[model samples]
Target: MKVGFDGKRATQNITGLGNYSRYLIRLLTKFHPHNQFLIYAITIPPPELAISEVEYRYPGKQLIKSYWRSFGIIKNLLRDNIDLFHGLSNEIPYSLKTAGIPTVVTIHDLIFIRYPQYYSFIDRLIYKYKYRYAALHADKVIAISKQTKQDLMHYFGVNEDKIEVIYQDCDVIFHQQVTSLMKDEIKKKYQLPEKYLLNVGTIEERKNLMLIAKALLRIDNIHLVVVGRETKYTLTVKQFIKQNQLSERVHFLHNVAHCDLPAIYQHAELLIYPSRFEGFGIPIVEALHSGIPVIAAKGSCLEEAGGPGSIYIDPDDDVELAKQVKGIIDNNETKMKMVRMGKQYLDNFKSKLISDQTIHLYQNVIDNAKR
Candidate 1:
């Protein structure tokens, strides 16, 4: 079988959607080497992802490059005789179904619909239209979490059977145990506190980094290490830190190298993720794989991502967040229990298992299309 991918994020983005795209390709090639794979992208893939088994194709003309995936990529798929096309992002070429190719689209989240206030008006409109079109037209729709699947049915009225829930795995680097020497070196390089809580994700309003900063007021000794791209929301968090005189207690490490992330996770006491919503929290999985306990927000798909073993606190409650942090820090037995449980929960998201399931879906779609 020949499979093609919408590789925009795969080639260009280093995080989130890009990681998913690259990891999927990596797993499929590792576990199902018999099939041919093609990556369609306007930009060249980064050096780190220059895999030999995959063929890369670009748009024919610069004029069409901006919207090639939605408009002009079908011709390329047909030219390559692609038996299956997977949109690793939330959209596929609008003409893919019309071209009679079996298509699958991975919808990461419907947060724009679920929390409209968090997104701009135009973004919400565009996402709704693109998501609805892909969900309606694709042969199969893959939702990253059960919450996302439910959002598809509720917001767009997509049929239940049309959506499949597939969880994503963290990078293999997180699964490796870092040596204490390497941990100390990375900690020294980053000037991380001797004991600190970690938070990984964008510094955006919806991520709710302020809650974690507020929690710091009630807790002592332990600092908070935040790593991610900063947005305007970051200023609000910084202002809160200044007003509360937490300059020394909260550290923001922006654009840290991906290779160094595991050491940071390995040396951390725990991960605190207070996001208001998520499709799936990859950081929680990374924490679990890194053998660290996680304290994440309650009342969303985080429970599904962090699993039952991880602690959950109300997103709005800073007092409760402080208490959980202190409790986990003071009680070694409880922290160890959470770590053990998290490790057990991570088995369900093993890369090979997810890859095989995705391959099965592709085969089913192809067979049904042929009939």
Candidate 2:
């Protein structure tokens, strides 16, 4: 059987869905060498990257249709005589179902659906239309977490069987081994405090940085070292920090190197992810696997990622959030217990296991199609 995947999100500085797309491709190639895989990418998007038996076919800009939305993708499906074409991102050509081909799509989250406030009116319309298109058209949809699967069933009325739950894995390189001295050196290199709480994600309102800043203002002992790109909303946090005289207490770091992230996780006192919503919290799992305790927001997919490994806090309540952070730091026994349970929780989320399960889904989808 021949399978094709979207080559669009494979560009540099990949994060979230882009990382998911790339990792899925890499893992599929490693685990299933006998199957023919085509990575269908466009120009500048670049394609034809191979790992062992898998081939990336970037059907250049000339062959691809000239428009941007579902129309151009429809042309690609019409042109490629493939067994199955999967749109890794959410959008799919309206014509794909009509082309007598099978397609799979992955829905990372319905953040736009849940928090329509974050998006512009025009963007909201686009999101609604595209989500409806993908939900109605795709042969099968993969949800990154059970929460996402539930969201699809609740919001879009997608058939539960058509939606398969597949959890994502952390980067293989994240579980790096660094000595105590080396970890200390990394800490000094960043000028980070000996015991600081870390947060990793794009700095945005939905990420709930304001709540975190409010909590940081209450906590006197620990510093907050945030790692993510700056946005307009981040300036709001910065302004709050200055206005509240937390100039030294609250910190921000941007454009962090992937190589440097593992050490950042390992040496830190703990990781604090208080996002209002998420498809999956990859950093929480990374911190858990690294034996670092996690403090995450209570609702949404953050709870799913935390499972039994993390301590949950309400994103809206700064007093409660700060209390939890302090509770963990003040009590060594509770901190140690969370660390051990977090490691055990991480055992279920390994990259290889996820890859095998995904392969099973692909084979089942194809075999059922054959019948």
What does candidate 1's lDDT look like per residue over 1-371, in tens digits? 99999889999888899999999998999999999999999988768866677899999666868778788888889999999999999988887777999999999999998899988899998888988999999999999999999999998899999999999998999989999999989988999999999999999999999999999999999999999999999999999999999998999996799999999998999999999999999999999999999999987799999998998999999999999999999999999999999999998899889999999999999999999
lDDT string for model 2 (63-130, tens) is 43335334565555556667777778776666876777777888888888899989998998998788
lDDT, candidate 2, equals 0.79
Clashes of 1: 0
Alpha-carbon RMSD, candidate 2: 2.5
The TM-score that candidate 1 achieves is: 0.98
After superposition, candidate 1 runs with Cα above 4 Å error = none
The TM-score, computed over Cα atoms with residue i paired to residue i, of candidate 2 is 0.92
Give the C-alpha miss distance for residue 320 in model 1, angstroms.
Answer: 0.7
* After superposition, candidate 2 runs with Cα above 4 Å error: 44-53, 61-81
Candidate 1 lDDT score at position 177: 94
lDDT, candidate 2, at 239: 92
Best by TM-score: 1
What are the clash counts of all predictions, listed in order? 0, 0
